[model samples]
Target: MSDAEAARALAEGHLVILPTETVYGLAADAGNAVAVAAIFEAKGRPRFNPLIAHVADAVQAEAIAVFDARARALAEAFWPGPLTIVAPVRDRDRVCDLARAGLDSVAVRVPGHARARAVIAAFGGPVVAPSANRSGRPSPTTFADAVEETGAFAAAALDGGDCAVGVESTVVSVLDGRVSLLRPGSVTREEIEAVVGPLDRDGEGHRSPGRMALHYAPDAPVRIDVVEPRPDEILLGFGPGVGALRWSLSPSGDLREAAANLFRRLREADREQPAGIAVSPIPAQGLGEAINDRLRRAAGFVG
Candidate 1:
């Protein structure tokens, strides 16, 4: 569908599937309590887990969430990209309490996808969009996977091709004059620290999305940092040494390329109905941190 159609659906308090740089999102009007509730119902998402309110720009983001100096600097450096800032809610009416999960703070971001921005601009309001998949499932990074996952619940679906950043946005909390890394994504901790100095490793009291111990998982079991795959297992290789049947995230060990292909490969491996999925070791640096985060969650090894 077109952006105008998607915006119209959102304005009428209906769910819409929108494509973003990170992944396809199931979007709904944030201010509409009933509409926001539908998202939880459709995705089987827990109400306590808050949704991320996607805006067109930093100006719109500031109107909904209180942006401190750190938040502003991060926004100036990373707006229109895969970075979400959780801050105190400035406009409660614009983002309903349900969307914020009854918290006083809201997680908001300006998506880098132009079509997504266009839809938000046409809708003329903030929209709560979470990964377009069932709760705890791997987020859909392609239009086909998104439609298959939750298209029945949406009033319209906009296809913006494949997502560039396969993982979700890097989420950070800029509360109490301190910046804490809530969730890592394509934007690394190093990048955020460069703009806002050191980040507190502890993210207590900062409710961010996608924090479940077991999330972004596939049907088959996942084993991370595996050097070899079992006979019945499907191996997702990283750099080199990939066998004929194995899938390589990046033959050259490019973290960015691996991030872009992470979910898609997981989905493919799951389709094979393997006994388990074995993943090659990925370095814990830059985009690899985010990739490893998702992998750990997929393997149900995260705390």
Candidate 2:
């Protein structure tokens, strides 16, 4: 579908599947309570988990949320990228309480996908979007999977090819004069710290999204840090020397490449109906942190 069509669907309180750098999102007009509620009902997502309100630029973002100096600096450095900032709500009417999960704060971001920005720009307001998949399922990173996952619920679906990042945006909260890392993604903690000092790893009471303990799961069971896969399992390998059953994320051990392929590979492996999905060990640095974070959640190892 065209951007104009998607925007029209959103304006009429309908759901639209949109692609972003991170993953395909099921989008709705943030200001419309009925539209935002459709997202939760379609995804079967928990009402307590807030949705990220996407805008065309930082100017639109600031209009919805109160951006502090830290928030502004981070926005200046990472707007139009995969970074979400959770801040106190400046315009509750623009981003309704339902979209914010009834919290006083709202999670907002400027997506780096041209088509997504075009749709939001055409809509002329904040769009509350979450990964286009059923709750607890792996997020769709391709147009085909997005349509297969939740197309029935969307009024229109925009095909923007495959997502580049294949992960959700890195979410951080700039509240109470402190920066807290709510969720990791393609953006690393080291990079964020460089921009705004250290980050509070323990974000206790923050209303950030994507914090479910058993998220990004697939139908098949997942086993992380596996050296050898069981006979009936599919091995998702990393780096070189991954003999037999070689579904290598990156043969050269490149974290960025691995991050881009994470969700797509998980979906592919799940389609095989294997006994379990085995993943090789990935380093806990850079984009690997986000990759491993998703892997751990898929394996139901995260608490």
Candidate 1 lDDT by residue in tens digits, 1-303: 788888998999999999999999999999999999999999999899999999999989989999889899999999899999999999999999999999999999999999999999999989999999999999999999999999999999999999998999999999887899999999899999999999997785339898888889999999999887899999899886664434889888899989999999999999999899999999998999899999999999763
lDDT of 1 at 168: 97
Record all residue pairs in model 1 with backbone atoms less than 3 Å apart, i.e. clashing: none
| Model 2 lDDT per residue over 1-303, tens place | 788888998999999999999999999999999888888888999999999999999999999999999999999998899999999999999999899989999999999999999999999999998999999999999999999989999999999989998899999999999899888888889999999999987684448788788889999999999997899999888888773434778888888888888888889989989999999899998888899889988988763
Stretches of candidate 1 above 4 Å error?
none
lDDT of 2 at 55: 99
Query: TM-scores, in order shown?
Result: 0.98, 0.97
What's the TM for model 2? Answer: 0.97
The 10 consecutive residues of candidate 1 with the worst lDDT sum are: 238-247
> Each candidate: what lDDT?
0.92, 0.90
